[model samples]
Target: MAIPKSAERSEVGAHQGSGEIRLVDVTKKFGGSYAVQNINLTIPHGSYCCLLGPSGCGKTTILRMIAGHETPSSGEIFIGDQMMIGKRPVERGTAMMFQSYALFPHLTVLDNVAFYLKMRGVGKEERRQKAEEMLQRVQLDHLKDRMPGQLSGGQQQRVALARSLITNPKVLLLEEPLSALDEFLRLKMRGELKSLQNELGITFVHVTHTQPEAIALADMVVVMDTGRIDQADTANVIFDRPKTPYVARFMGGQNVLTGTVESLSGGLARLRNADGATFEAATGALEAKAGSPMSIAVRRDRIKLRKRLADQVLSAVNEISGIVDSTEYQGSYIKVTVDLGGGVFVVNVSDSEYFVDAVVRGDLVTASWTTADVHTLSKVDMGAIDDPYLDATQ
Candidate 1:
C-alpha cells in the first residue's frame, strides 16, 4: 500500500535530530516484582515522546534510569552514542524538571537560573547574562529579582524551566513537570513546553499520566502497561487505531462491543454482539476468519443519537436501541447515558438541540455509527478497556 505524504512527513519528523535514545530490554525489579519488564523502545531524535501510563506503571522508573538517578537491573540505556549505565545524573547530558519547581525562596529568578552555570565555574557576569537570556525566552525576565515566594505557581514553573535549559542538555526529561500547576496554568504550560522543545530542537522525553497532556505535547506517545510497552505510536494512531484492548480502554472515550465475526469481505466485517445485536465495521488491518469472535469499539461521539419518533431522515447505518438511564448537562455537550441491556453507553451531543431535556430517563433512543468509525478488537471487554484504576504495575 502506498503511504500517504502526510504519513511520510510524520515518519521523517519522528526521526529528526540524530540524538536517538534506545531502551534495550530494560527492567527494574524490586523485591521479586518487576517495575519495568523487558521494555525495549527506540525514541527518535528530537522527538517529543511521552511515557504515558497510570501511577506505578514504571514510567518514572524508566525516566530515572535514563537520567542515571536509578540504574536498570537488566538492560542497557543509550543516549545518542553514550552508555548511561554507570554515569551519575550530572554526568549524562540530561536535565530533569520535576513536578515541584524546587526554586530557592531566597534567590531571585536570575540567581536561580544562573546557579547551574556558576557550578560549571563560568564567570559571574557571563552566567548572569545567560540566565537573563533564558528568562527572556520563558518570558520571565521582568520578574528576575522576585524571590520564589513572590512568584506565582506558573511563574515559578518558568523559572524551573529556564534553570534546566541553561546548560543545553541533549535530552530534557520532564517528569510530570506541569502536574503541580493549577488546571489553567497546566493547560497554558503545555503549549509553552511544546514551543520550547521545537525552538531548541532537543530530544524531550516527558512522562505523565494525563492522557490529554500526552496527546497535546507528544509527537510520539509510548503507552505502557504491566511494565511493558502496550503500543508506541503517534498520538493519532495510539488513540484512533489502538492495537490492543488495554490501549483501547486506557485511552478512554470508546465503547468496546464484543462480538463474533460473522463474515468479512471488501474491507468490512459483520459482527454479532454478545447480546445478539449485529453491526458492521470497516476492518482496515484486522484479520479474522468467519465465526471468530472479536470486539469492536466506537467512540461515543462518533455514535449519532436519534429520537425514536423524530421524522428526520435516518441515514443508513448500524443501530442499537437503548433507554436513557441518566443525563448530564456539560456546557459544550450533553452526556446521555443509555443502558443497552448488557452494558451502558455514554454518548455526547454537541448540538444544543439535544439538551439534557431532549432525552429524559426511560426515553428510548437509537445510537448509530457508520462502519468506518467502528474499531475492531480481537479479545477484550469494556471492563478491561475502561478501568483506568487497574493495577498497571502487576
Candidate 2:
C-alpha cells in the first residue's frame, strides 16, 4: 500500500521535534542486480533498530537508501508524514555514521564534530559549546584537541558519533560503525553505544555484519538475506524460536537430522531417522504426520553427554549412543564431537568438566536430551520454517 504524502514541510523558523519514519516497498537495484528488494520497515521515534546480515546480504544497501546515498529504485520514504522522495539526507532530519570513521586527518576532534554545525550557519561559540557537550557525552572531552590520526580506533569512533549526533538528528543511520575496532574495544564500545542511544532517545538504525553486535544493541533486529528480510523480531523471540532451518543454524551451531514420524502418542512422536535409527521428540507447531519425512534440530549445548552404556540411559526418550571423536578447547568451554554413526555431533561443556584428555576419541559415549530441546521442521513446506535467512550453507 502507498503511504500518503506529507501535507507540508516544516518551516525553518520553527524548531520542531523529531518524528517516526516509514519505508514502504523499498527496493534498490545496481544495473540488472538487486542490491535490496521489497523492504518494508517502520522506525518509531526513540527506538533502536538494527539491520543484521552477512556480507553481500543487502544490509548496507538498505542503510544507504535511508541515508539518501542510494535512491530507491521504486519506493516511498516517509519521515513522520512527510514524503522524502528526491529530498537530500540533511533536509530529511537524519545523520549518518559511516564504518570508516570519516574524520579529517588534519582536523582536531572538536573541529571534526563542529564542522557540520558550522556549515548550518550556527555561531562559532554555540557550535564549540555544543561540540564540547557531545564530546563529553562520548567521554572524549579530554581528547578534543587531538587529531583523528593521533587517536586510537575506539577514540576515533567516539569522534564520529559525536559529529553525527551534534546535529541532533531525528534518525541516525549507522553502517557498521564498530567494524574497524578490535575485539575488546568493540565490546566496550557496544555498551557505550547502547547507553548513548538510550540517553539521546533518538531513532537509531544501525547496520552490522556481526551477529552479536546487532543482538546486543538492537531493540528490534531485522535479519536480511539475498536482498530480502528473513525475519524481524525481538532478540529473545529470534533466538528462542527461529522459524526456519537456516535461521536455527545461523543463530548458533545446531545439529539438524532428517527423519520421519513412525508413531505419535502422549504428546510425543517416534521418529525414524533416514539412517534407520529411532528416537522420540516433543511435538511442535509443524505436526509430523505418520510416515511423513521431517527435519529435527537441537542446539549443541542443549544435548547432554554421559559416559554410560547405551542400555543404562533412558532409552525411551531422545537418547543416542555415540563415540567421542575429538575435543576442542574454547577457553570457557570445550566442544566435544561425538560420532553418532551418520555425522559428528557437538556438545559444549564447561572446561573444568569436559577436558581434552578426559575422554579419548575411541571411548563410547551416550548423548541424550529432553523433548523440550528438540525442534521439528518440515521439508515440504519450506515457508513454514522459522528462519529462512539462516545461512545453513555456512
Candidate 3:
C-alpha cells in the first residue's frame, strides 16, 4: 500500500526528545496468579500504541508498570535506553493521565496546571507563563480562572491534560483516559487525543477495551487475552489477517469456521463436520490431507446470502444453510444473523443491496463466501461460533 502524505511528513514541532519504549521478559504475579506473563514488546519512538483487552486481561497492569506505579515481578523495562524499575514517575521522563482526570476541585485551572511546576520549585512568574502556554495549547486558556466544579467535563479534561504535559515528559501514558466521558464526548476526545499525539510527535501508550478505540488511534495495537498477547501488529494487519480463532471472534467482523478436512485435490480442499454438512475452502500454504482438522475464518462482509430452495443445498463451493434469525439496519449496511442449527453467523450487506435481497426473517437461506476470502486459524476453541452477547443487540 502507498504511504499517505501526512504520514511521510517530517516531525519538526515536537516536545520531549525521546518516546521509545521497550519491555523485555516482563512478568507480574499476584497471589499465586500471574496478571502479566512474560511479555516482550517494543513501541517505536514517536508512535501511538494501545494496549487493548477485556477486564482482568492484564492490560492495566502492564500500563501501570510502565507508568512506574507498579513494579514487575520479573524482567526489565526501558524508556529510551534507561531502565525504569526503581525510578519514580518523574525521574523516568514519563507522565500519566489518569482516567478520573484527577483535577483539583479547590484550585483554579491555572493553579491546577502550575502545581507540577510548584513541586519542581520553579519561579512563580515563569511557571505561570509556562502553564498559560500549555493551557493555550489545549485551548483552555480562557477558562484559567474557573475551578474544576465550574468547568464542563471536556474543559476539566483539558485542564488535566495541560497539567500532565507541562513537565515536558518523554512519553505519556494514558490509562482509560476517555473511559470516563459520555459517548459523544468520548468520540470527540478520541480525535483530539490522536491529533495531539501527532502534533507533539511523542509516544502515547493508551489502554482501552474498546475495539474501535484501539483501531482508530493506534499505530501499533497490542491485543491481550487473559495475561497473554493474542496478536500485536498494525491495526490493519490484525483486523485483516488474524492468526487465531479467538482473535477473529474477539476482534469482531469475522466468522470462524471449523470442521475436518475431508479431501484435498487440485488446490482445493473439502471440509465436513459431524452432521455430514460439507463445504469447500482454499488450501493456501497449508499441507492438507484427508481426515485432518481444519479451522478458517471469512470476513463477515464478504458473505453473500441467497434464499434456499428445495434440492438446492450448496453454492459453487463453500455454502451454509441457515434460518435468518435477526436483521439490523446499520445506516450504510444491514446486519443479518443466521442460525445454522449448531452455530450462529453474521453477514453485513449493503443497505441498497439488502432491500432487494429475497431472504427475510425466519426464511431459509444459504450464506456463501469465496475461497479467496478464507483465512486459516491456529489457536482457539474450534468447537462452534455462537456469541451470547450478540443476542442482546439492539
Point to the candidate with the largest lDDT: 3
Q: What are the clashing pairs of model 1?
A: 249-385
Instruction: List the candidates' TM-scores in order.
Output: 0.86, 0.83, 0.91
- Give a tens-digit lDDT track for model 1, residues 1-394: 1122332111111222356789999989988999999999999888999999888899999998988888899999988877779987656778888778788777888999998878878788988887887787777889998889998888888889888877667788998988888898888889888987887678899999988889898999999986889999999988887777677777766776777788988988888876667889777776777887777778877878866764444334377777899878778777788998867777877757585348788888888888878887755554654463631211
Candidate 1's TM-score: 0.86
State, as a TM-score between 0 and 1, how close model 3 is to the true structure.
0.91
Please give the CA lDDT of all the candidate structures. 0.79, 0.76, 0.82
* Higher-lDDT candidate of 2 and 3: 3
Residue 365 local lDDT, model 2: 84
Any runs in candidate 3 off by more than 4 Å, and if so which? 1-17, 265-269, 282-289, 380-394
- Give candidate 3's error at residue 292 in angstroms: 3.0
* Per-residue alpha-carbon lDDT of candidate 2 for residues 345-390, written as tens digits (9 for 90 to 100): 7777677677533776778887778878887654432322444344
Against the hidden true structure, what lDDT does model 3 obtain?
Answer: 0.82
Candidate 3 residue pairs in clash (backbone atoms < 3 Å): none
* lDDT: worst 10-residue window of model 2: 1-10
